[model samples]
Target: MQSDSKILAKINQTVDRLSDPESYDLVCHEHRLGEPLPSTEKLAKIVNMIREILFPGYFGTTSLRPNTIKHYMGVYVDELFELLSEQIMAGLCFTCKNPHEVDMQERNRHAQMLASEFIAYLPEIRRKLVADVDTAFVGDPAAQSQSEVIFCYPAIRAISNYRIANQLLKLEVPLIPRIISEMAHSETGIDIHPKAEIGESFTIDHGTGVVIGSTCIIGNNVKLYQGVTLGAKSFPLDEDGNPIKGVPRHPIVEDGVIIYAQATILGRVTVGANSVVGGNVWVTNNVPPNSKIVQFKARETSFSDGAGI
Candidate 1:
């Protein structure tokens, strides 16, 4: 019912308001003019390539034989190196506060070096992931084989992402590690922070709604079930009322511990080695080694004779 010219003018006014720099300055990321941003699609491809390399015939190539495995590994490694280096460079550029001050050539060389170092570390990652898969297969009676665990379990997928992202975090290549971890979170409903220090032989069963926070130090051979949250109980706020960053706030889970479904462990508490935390329990204090923490049983009430009391 409005005039075409008037509607166009109104739309132009809204566009002008949205284009105002003042409106989005706080949230906007202003990067170098020609620098590339990190791409989630490319990172997803990188993850898939890493999986294919790690699991061989289990992932990408069905026709892979022992004789030709080396050839496939070579091809995957080359492609992964190219993709990873570019993403690392993009991450570096994305986090640079003053991009003009950075030497682009040196940054590219550094990214390439990091990618090569990561490639060399692939064997170590594979070793840890093998342990994880074995643990998952052994722990779950429903799992027929380690290969089945590798192919069917969401925990393996989530843990693989965490391992890769944690290695990248160790290399101090910003942005990409968190992105990689979040990709797994989106797919598996399991959120393991890249900064969390998780040891080998870890397994999560029925892994939905699991949240492992940054600064959580999980020991070797630990297992967690669904709906488990290892999170901070409270944040230490600064004068500006913002939570302080880089503080060790999450729980430290020791070796051989099993946290059952829906357990919430918060703050900087320690769950000692070989402990079993029962389901739906809220733990905030330090638990001793070889302890079992469970909820108190519900009471049964006796009723008087009907309408006679």
Candidate 2:
């Protein structure tokens, strides 16, 4: 009875509060929404599945017959188009202030067209990505096969996805490019901005902690080691002391340059062709062609010998 009385008292108090004049005006609007959009992991998995089907045995599951491959790809492409279109519309709506006036049909149509174009570009993307794999294989002696590079190399995965998404970004299809690049970043720990311009024949060895910032222009035959960061030093600030956006941040690495492990090359400085940046060096100034930079008083040591005495 005491428990019942306590419950009744609480209910009566709530009713009384709702009936109050101030509380009545305060009760404005509320509605329960559905589950949020699909996660980046799931989206990435879908993309991976599509890539696998498109370039069979390259990524994801490899079990399939010759006849079934076409059917499976068709199904996945259909589903991807649907899911991508929905997510794109959601992104478009999120960015728009006047959401109701935004046309879902137009957005969906544009997304579908871009998605098709992206699908068509896959063959060319694969052709270019094969060169990246070749570069990695030829550059790294430990790399066994093209398959190994495709499966185990983080740089290939990150760069391949970036190039694929960059084409779409260049087409100006909105938020999908950033989403795709972030998906790669989460998986590989290699954060390459989609806007960064990278040339052909680029290879990254043991690519962890690799960050290539936006506005970076990397040329052909460039090789990067793990933990190498091509970044900007500082941005020019506005009158309010806020950092300005879209300035020429990050370095311009010319063709045939090699940057060793843990090197941080910053600013709009250019590293000319055939230049070699040694490990653990912080470079802010421009480097002329054929320049080799190594740390002062550094001695060569083997991996088994343990670093420094």
Candidate 3:
């Protein structure tokens, strides 16, 4: 055992080494003096508030009545605006290359404007969410009702998060959208990138392990199952050997396509409209419209007595 003085000295030395700027300069985040950082807790609250506003009587503490619905909406919208504006400001500051040169007051006003615009888009978001809930209810035979789907389905939660994040991404609010999407990904095992272009009435059954990559265009009425991977096959490298960014590298699924569980569709291939991709298949090429792709049958084996000779 070491002496008390020696132990304290060793601990101090370790702390000093760890705190050295050279140790973490590459990955360290050094923000402007007064600029705020995005808070996951606040973003989570924002998501909950959106859900409550979108599906009244389904989330939050308020017992909503027909006459008071507008009042509740007003309150929720007001709160959401403030929270969103703060987070958006934080996101703007987080991405600023020259924080010293930028006007903080102007940025704050811009954030407030973006928040107001997002609030105005709430009705549209609610419309899409209602469609999604209806689709889930109609598509799943086991679903008792649309209410049940909204109350219980992980797919609903994931898709709702994606929809909200997608809208934010469209508004070009950086960092925050990705954070919102990732919050859902952590809770539900579905990973839909905010940049992914997914149309209305999209459903993911048993959504765990589903991965929809950025640049993937999924058409309306498309369905996916568990363990499905709509991912990139290979990266197109630059002259300096870095993988090129923003290239279309993931598969595009056209309208009315159904991809079964564990199917892996890679590269920039197009799965045409009304196609059905069967379970556990590996697809790297284009699938024609109305085509059905499935794995070949396994070979049969005969045993001599209890074991093969």
The residue-by-residue lDDT of candidate 1 on 1-309, one tens digit each, is: 999999999999999999899999999987667787999999999999999998888887635788888888888899999999999999999998877788999999999999999989999999999999999999999999998999899999999999999999999999999999999999999999999999989999989999999999999999999999999999999999999999999999999999999999999999999999999999999999999999999876666775433
Q: Write one digit per residue (lDDT tens) for candidate 3, span 132-232.
A: 88888899999999989998999999999999999998899999999999999999999999999998898999899999999999999999999999999
Candidate 3 vs. true structure, TM-score: 0.97
Q: Give each model a TM-score.
A: 0.95, 0.80, 0.97
lDDT of 1 at 24: 97
Candidate that would win on TM-score: 3
Candidate 2 C-alpha lDDT tens digits along 1-309: 579889999999999988777765655422213312435765676568656755576666665678787877777777777766665555554455664565667766776777677677777777878788899999888988877887788888799778866887777766667888888898889999999999998998988999999899999999999999999898899999999999998999999999999999999999999999999999999999999988998567667566455
- lDDT score, candidate 1, position 156: 96
Model 2: lDDT equals 0.80
Instruction: Name the runs in model 3 displaced over 4 angstroms.
Output: 303-309
Task: List the pairs of residues colliding in candidate 2.
Answer: none
| Candidate 1: residue 7 lDDT (0-100) | 100
